[model samples]
Target chain A: MSAFNESFRFGIRNIRKRPYRSFCLVLAAVIGSYALFVGLALKASLNNGIGRMQERMGADLMIVPESSEIEARNILLTGEPEFFYMDVAVATAAAEIEGVECATSQFYFTSLSSDCCSTRVQLIAFDPDTDFVIGPWIDERVTSDVSNGSVIIGSEVTPLSNGKVKFYGNEYSVAGKLGETATGLDHSVFMSRDTMHGILNDAKDKGYQFLNPEDDGAWVSTVLLRVSDDADITAVEKEIYNRAGGIRFIETDKLISDVAVKLGSVENIINVTLTVLLVFSFLTMILFFSVIFHERKKEFAVLRILGTSSRRICFFSLTEGITIGAAGGIIGLVLGILTVFPFNHYIENSLDVPYLMPSVAAVILYGMIGVLVTTLFGSLSSFLSTLSLAHAETYYTMRTGE
Target chain B: MAFLEAQKLVKEYNRRGKTFRAVDDIDFTIEPGDFVMIEGESGSGKTTFLNLLTGLTDPTSGAVIIDGRSLKETGDKEISKIRNQKIKYIPQGESLLSALTVRENILFPFTIGGLERPSEERLLEVSDKLGITDLLDEYPSDLSGGEMRRATIARAVINKPSLIIADEPTGSLDSANTFKVMEIFRDIASEGTAVIVVTHQKETLGYATRVLEMDQGSLKEVV
Candidate 1:
């Protein structure tokens, strides 16, 4: 056998000889690795979720009906279905305001939970000619235009086998499905204004009373506005409020900033917990190796007298540490997968924040990094103790042991 | 040429600014097949002299030359190889690793340097010579004192070194076991290997071809 192989075998034998000590070291590594894996996964999920939200809210500001500001925020942030309307003239007025680069109107309609629909979901209608927010998203997903007879479904929406979706007894061809945005939009359906009016007429024929006394097609639920890049956002908000009489403005940046603050708090907690766990595990390894060296001083002295080089002795000790670390790291990552993946939705809901798990390849990469880092640190801790013992006078060490 | 030579060796210790010599100007030599015994009182520095001979410690002045090469001039790796291949040291206590079987302990010297191990037949032969063939698979904790000593001797001689340096080999053994151990050393020396044994027992002198006594860091031949 090569010296390295013999050292590895000897290390394994030593670990087996002191089962309790090895167990303690392994436990320390496990706790540290588990914390690292779970913390990284949670942080990555939140960051990804926030990034998607920022991309989805392309509009700088949202103009909703008076007194429905909170409801509009809920719809945009969480994808909850809510409907309120203002005169469609507000879209024209907002577009005419100075510093307003683009303005578009959207109509919200919540479908009924009756047999007339496949599932109760939110229906969002955007004008294909004057749309800026949803137009680019639709263009990317659907090869053909979103015509009056077709609808684009969200990632969570299931279409019938015939590649069609039904709402209020009217069937529309499914053009495409949007990818996940980790928001209520994932459960919503998007369509052109003409298809939306057809759904409304079908709903009316099915005895639904969605029309108000003053109802006309000239009403829109919310007006999305994009301010010019060089324009001051506060000045534009003031100009919109001064120009519009019965509309509440929601700054998209403010919404994202609020979520960012919450994400920051969560990241802080995770980082602190990870730091504490790593420090505790590192200290435990150092202490464990110190005790092991003290107990094995004579053994090392004997090896030295038997023609084992000092470097070889240190390598033997380091091998034991690396073995314990790798074993613990793998076990910890397995436990992390079991804990995080099974309760993914629960964790997101409990945290009341957007969360998106990373891809399979990313998870595997992180696991490998965790094992490598743990093994490195484990060997480093053992090296500190082994270095001194290896260089000690063999006769003095043996005599002291006796 | 002498198989081993100690030339005016001196080892000193400094305590509270006072210098004490453990082995003072000790000149010694041993030829091949010499069964030598060194007897000394508790503080007479016999173990210190053995340490110098084995290159375990450097002498403050003078040198030990083995087979014409000075120990002081050799580097650690070369000295360690010499210790492994040419000389064997059996320390004064129970030195077997508790984690390994007696056979593994005997084979450890070869494994440590990645050297090709002796054949199983050779191992059995050594065990048979030491009367420890039945205890090859047993750990150090399970062996009696005499059995452990014999196992240690087997480990020492497994490489068939040219010289053996044993310190207090029978310090804790009974009269019968001590005689058995000394007779084994005598038989080993008769086969052309040099043997040096340091002890406080006068009974061991009968088995030595040359007996030396140490007092106050000086050695004198008694026979």
Candidate 2:
């Protein structure tokens, strides 16, 4: 252990000895970790915020006419291959299954999207007035009487000119814009069930007809179904799968799991990101230890002569890497949160997409994994490099002072 | 048996289709408290022979026996402990870690071996004796050649080993620091510690009780 401490002391001193190379090494690590942390944080934040927003869907199951779970998962994960909805009948039938409670359906209309338009008008939708789950969820975002012809605008989606407007051509007022949900809800416009139906019927050609309406009528895009109070969620999910038949039953667990898999699985884009970050991390560590390795060759040779085992050298290298990695992980974690919050706020403002930091467990776990991986990488590389020399005669290595 | 002994030591290397004998078969010994000097020109295999004696290198044939253990029989770690507890080596050129303060550099050997030299009295005694008491905070990069040599010597002696080994410890110093380093050696030898220095400077012979010169990788006594 003293030998380990000595090697670490030597490692730090060597860094001081070659300030330029050490600076470049640490700078590379900080910046590389920064990029990785920010990417991870932003990805996680969006997933979390949208996840929180989707909680308003208020059920353990999401019913869609399209059974493409992978595409649905991807869309939920990274906003790819945008929203897919099913006929409103899917919701009404879903409520008849065992262990099921009330199921509600809603219609969504993509609002005016542009930089010049001030009145946020995205995801303008209608919810069934008698529904318990989906209707109440939107209630949080809408915060209006919602009974009359009045329309509730999101913080972003305002009137056509940021001025007041009649609700769905009804004689109702705009009521008022509501507080932010920090999600896509920021740009959503909410109106009464009757008013929303009228607008969707007018834009019915592209809106509700986006899904097959031939055998489907009184159609809606999303169905939020709640389980009975005494029913098990997992069992209810299975019941959902059995009853939905042709429709896609998205078990919320599978929903979140799919997102995680796509973000980090080995062959996916997350895999490409993983490869890039690993290479970058490896190169950063190698450059760091290599420079320190050259400076400390004599010290190591001397230690070997003084009796330090090769394993000891290897272990010391591991410890040194761990030390630096732990520091970087912690700093990177805090920096990641601080970095994402402001940018996320700006995203909510400019893009009207809400983002927030991931859960604490995710933040800590991701950081810890990152540190462990980099430590193993840096230590193994430097250790193998140092121990390769430990085999040759220690005396000769230090004799000519090369 | 001598305090330190080498028997029929041989070191050879084949380079460019030709064999170069770094050290031919040689036998020698050092008694306790001896002030011995091994003087030779550059590339005379003086270091090669010294390395074998110190167990820093393996001899092609023959053996180095220090105290009671054989270098070949003992493991590298045991050999290091033996060297650390019984002998101190001063390499050619500046031997201090460039980033450490003079005091920290002096305390390096003990620290590497995990021994403590408290700052209360032991440190003061050594620092005061070596005239480095005032320069404890300065790094080797800032020290003069003479001061670096002194600081290294202080580090070497901190363990109070039975033998002090110097490889051209005076080569880089001015006349004053060279003489100063030599006087420090004499003082260490006076305390019953064996002092063996490797140098090509004939002028340093004045301080040696006995001088051995290497010719064509062979040692001949000239005292």
Best by TM-score: 1
Q: Which ten residues in a row have the lowest lDDT in candidate 2 chain B?
A: B111-120
Instruction: For candidate 1, write residues B10-99 as lDDT tens digits.
Output: 999887999999999999999889999999898899888988998888899999999999999998888888888888999888888878
Which ten-residue region of model 2 chain A has the weakest summed lDDT? A111-120
Residue B153 in model 1: lDDT: 84
Alpha carbon lDDT of each predicted model: 0.85, 0.65
Q: Give a tens-digit lDDT track for model 2, residues A98-131.
A: 8777676755544323332232244444455546
Which of the CAPRI classes, incorrect, acceptable, medium or high, describes model 1?
medium
What's every prediction's RMSD, in angstroms? 3.2, 8.4
How far out, in Å, is residue B45 in model 1?
Answer: 2.5
How far does residue A305 in candidate 1 sit from its true spot (Å)?
1.3
Residue B99 in model 2: shift from native, Å?
1.6
Clashing pairs in 2: A45-A356, A88-A219, A88-A220, A111-A121, A119-A158, A120-A156, A120-A157, A120-A158, A121-A157, A182-A354
Candidate 2 lDDT for residue A217: 45
Best by lDDT: 1
